[model samples]
Target: MKFGYLSISINFARQIPMLNPTTGEIALFHALLDLKNIDMNFPSTTGKKKTWADGFDPTSATLQLYSGLSANGIVKAREKLKALGFIDFKSRGRRKSTIYKLLDLGSDKSAFNSSDNSVDISSDISGDNSSDNSSDNSVTLIKTKQDKTNTNNTSEKSQATPHEQKKKFSADSVEYRLAMYLFGKIKQNNPQHKDLTESQEQKWADHIRLMIERDNRTPQQIKNMIDWSQADSFWRQNILSTAKLRKQYDTMAPKANSEWQTQQPRKRVYE
Candidate 1:
């Protein structure tokens, strides 16, 4: 459930347009195309919380409410987008939440310009039009036609390819869902910890991937790892740190025994 770098990156690459559509593999894609930045610690307004219309996805906003960045509804959305290769998030943990940086979409800039005439297709279509008295006019017309054709080609190429549009994975994927579950538990246990940055999430995903590789485990194994990680103090402490666990302990101390029954009290008897 806890994502490491590799797992997060792979999931992100799968979600974004940076992977090969045909093979469902990561390609020469960059994360910047979908996001420019991430800001987890943005101050919340006094009134009602923002909604998807306020630039956050509705589903993710709900998830964020239960996650580390509960104050700002954009946290979960940002994390999901980053994991999907849409943005890059940054954080140091001192603030209430993390920060995110979205990368610009990798649009072909020249396609947006109206003046580029690199492709000369008119000459190909008009063989004898150049020989007429009004050859100049004919040439101009041909150039315009060529420009249109070039523009169309550019537009098609700029659009997402079929492979890119394919949906290979979702939050329901065993790995991703588990990660979300773990994040929710962590947030529940330690509400004070700042949201996990993109890098940190990726690192966690990578750690999970490494464990998978080391154990040659199946997806089921990974799921079990997540379950164990959430329940096991040693594993969580090893991955997160004793300091973090201590914080969780402090937060849960009041209700801890009642909730978990770590120990059983002696039975009371009245004679």
Candidate 2:
């Protein structure tokens, strides 16, 4: 994709048609919003000591469906936006979504603000001189995103207390309680799991949050899995964590059913 001295805004979404060349530029701006913090992933642009996830972009299939554009058109448009520094893109391998970041868009700002609820294209970019800063603009784009990434990390640290530990779920929350309960069971079964370190607690807490927030598993479903997994001797050995529970849910259910069905029928007390 050619990186150019083009400045495009989201409000340009209105005056342009999808088939028009300008529409892809505007639509590419919207795609950045999808790379937000989902429960499953959080990708950051830069950080050496601390590992942070980069933002996630929706698949080309999804972008095409939403924007009424062909797949190639979406890729071409996305590349154009990347060229301009209005967006940042990071590939996370084939299985995971690509990450995107909307740069901080500093006061030398080229990004369009849709929150104002206006669609006026700025006169500055409307002319032929917009390309004058292409080289500088491209460099500024990644630098700003990297700066924003660092700032966000700093802000997170400032806001958190020792008690917070980046664990946003309350101690009283069902997810937290579920994590504790599961951990307690794991401890009961294995002598090695007895002492609960802070790291272990935090790790399971993340998995619990993933199950509740990302997987959309209901509290009742989690409760059922806990009960059933513990009751079955085989699963008591296998289903050790919430992460494992979610990963094995489909397989576990059928096995549980089959375990019950093939068991020796108890002498009927009263059917």
Candidate 3:
């Protein structure tokens, strides 16, 4: 069959042996058939890569099909092909290129004939006991399918919760949590230093944000007030220090208190 510019052929048999370009092995016919969807590309003598997109390019397709083989497998496959007189390859020099040519298999056509014989055998077997053979095959297929379904369900159930999953799936999210924890620790240690100037507070916030973004939350051991504020202690001190500083600086500044006191009057006894 031809789809677009790619051609596909299938040869079925009880034990069909052929060279597997992908794995460079002698495998059963069914195994090759299973790789029907793989895309292949080949290089031409003109040193240009060919593809199905440009009409039929079997040479490029064949080379691409063999590209997946391991180095050792490729060597073995080439040797086997040489022995069978099916293909020959030559290399000119260390840095030079190689060339390949296909040879006829002659009268050893039994390899291709096996595919036809297998079809006859299948027909004979099916005709002799059609109902019983079909029932057996159906039961086996059902069991295999059920086993796969159960395994997938078990896997899904073992998955983690969203919060836990997020932490596991993303290193950045985990770092964010650690940064929050470090800020909490910082705030806890600097209860009295809650009145940090605006610039100082902004600097610490920016640092925490950057650490979270970079996913670098390695803990440091410095105990200085500023260091503690940058560590995980910032969270704890945020609320307490904000309230205290507001009371001290906004409500009870000496000048503000004096003004409030002056505005108050003393009661006179004239009645």
Total residue pair clashes for candidate 2: 6
Best by TM-score: 2
Write one digit per residue (lDDT tens) for candidate 3, span 18-44: 332322433211112222212221234
Candidate with better TM-score, 2 vs 3: 2
Q: Which lDDT tens digits does candidate 2 get at residues 1-271?
A: 0011112222222113322336556545544442231211222345321111223457767767656678777667778766655566776787877665454333243333222211111111112322332332210010011233455432432122455457665444555556665664454345354455666666566666665544544444455466568657888899887667766665676655455445524421110
What RMSD does model 2 have?
22.9
Show the colliding residue pairs in model 2. Answer: 42-53, 43-53, 43-54, 44-53, 44-54, 55-99
| Ranking according to lDDT, highest score first | 2, 1, 3
User: What shift in Å separates residue 4 of candidate 2 from its native position after superposition?
Assistant: 62
For every candidate in turn, the CA RMSD to the true structure comes to 26.2, 22.9, 32.6
Q: If ranked by TM-score, best first, what sequence of candidates would result?
A: 2, 1, 3
Cα distance off (Å), candidate 1, residue 256 = 21
Residue 259 of model 2 has an lDDT of 50
Candidate 1 or 2, higher TM-score?
2
- Evaluated at residue 103, the lDDT of candidate 1 is 30
